[model samples]
Target: MSTWTEIGDRCWVRRYDEWDLNVGLVAGSDGAVVIDTRATAEQGSELLTHIRELTDVPVRWVVNTHAHFDHVVGNSVFTDATIYLHENAAAEEDLAGTTFSVAKVIDLGDRRVELLHLGNAHTSGDTVVVVPDADVFFVGDLVEESAPPSYGEDSFPLEWPDTIDRVIGMLSDTAKVVPGHGAVVDAEFVRDQAGDIGTVANTISGLHHAGTSLADALQHTEDWPWPLEQLQDAIKRGYGALGAPRRPTLPLLGPGSSA
Candidate 1:
């Protein structure tokens, strides 16, 4: 079962049991914006039903935080709404939607939603939805609460901490942040998570610099911040990243800076 929690004025987060996913909604007098479509068409349809309980206005926009299967597979359900995906994420999935390389502003009749591509963290393309009026931010897997940050084959583990630092710099001290798969959180929570991710990234860097082989990497780190299972991908990806040219980091956005 899923439950809806109002995190800000007219901004709500719907939490689902599967994947512990958190879908966001920001309703306006003229229309609404759904943050993510869930994991499947049937799940997306159910999400649409849950949305109706908040407002009857048409869903004018759908923003996929990233191209992860769970966050975007259900996009087809929002047939009429204009879906927004980061250009990199668009390449991963052949979903028809408006693609933005850096940022885009969505006019939701009475509300303004800023879709920002902060930097590569969990995936090459991750969108941070900022509802300026409500001070509510829909940050996908960039900041996870249910578990440690996910570092998949596509994740930029080496740059994950820096990406998260940019997110922290852009948030207000009191902003209500709705993570992709967790309950609503505050800036402090985001800060702490950034630190943890930084530790993971730093550890990976140190191990790589110390000539630690990928297979023998885990053996060297006796004090693991995250579960060993979760760190496997992080180690692999981090090492891979360290071997390549680093991507430039995006400029830090001031608190409430939409662009």
Candidate 2:
């Protein structure tokens, strides 16, 4: 089902229930701004159709919240709109860029979205799209409302809490947060999620640093709400981010081999 919630005067957060994917749309007299196109051409086409129902304004620009496949892979769908990405993503695209340490705001005529690049958070460059006037933030996967945070192979566990802190500072109690996948929530929800994820990061890092084997270290995460596979990935991210050696992939020994 295609459901949309009006967040501001002319802005909406559209959700495709099947994918649990949320895409931000902001329109003004001048043009419209689309945040994060869906993963494929077909999904992006469907999203465009949904956006067309909301506003007739032509989409002039597209902002990828991050360069993940689910987020940026739909770039090809927005042929007429200018695609913008963080410096690192630009590097991958081989485009000359500005390595913004803080953030930069793009004026969408009647609307303004501040792109804050929170270094080493969900990825090497994760940006939170802030609608200052609306007091809403389009947090990619940095803050998840549907589930616990997902740490990919590129995530930096040690830096996520601090990055989330930066996002928290930019929000107000009345602010609404649109996660990558889920219903819109408030600032407190985001804050609590960040705190819990931070705890997981710390626990994983501590266990790894204490020289706990990968299997035993994973046991410490049993109390965590995420899956074992996700925890294992986070453990690897934690170890890598902390400059610890990669977890050695030891072979399982059968009873005969053990003897």
lDDT of 2: 0.77
TM-score, predicted candidate 2 vs. hidden true structure: 0.86
Local distance difference test, each candidate: 0.86, 0.77
TM-scores of the candidates are 0.91, 0.86
| Candidate 1 error regions (>4 Å) | 244-259
Q: For model 2, how does the per-residue alpha-carbon lDDT over 131-209 read when each residue is reduced to its tens digit? A: 8887878888888778678787777778888889888887888998989888898988988888888887778876776
Off by over 4 Å in 2: 92-101, 221-225, 244-259
Candidate 2, residue 157: Cα displacement in angstroms equals 1.0
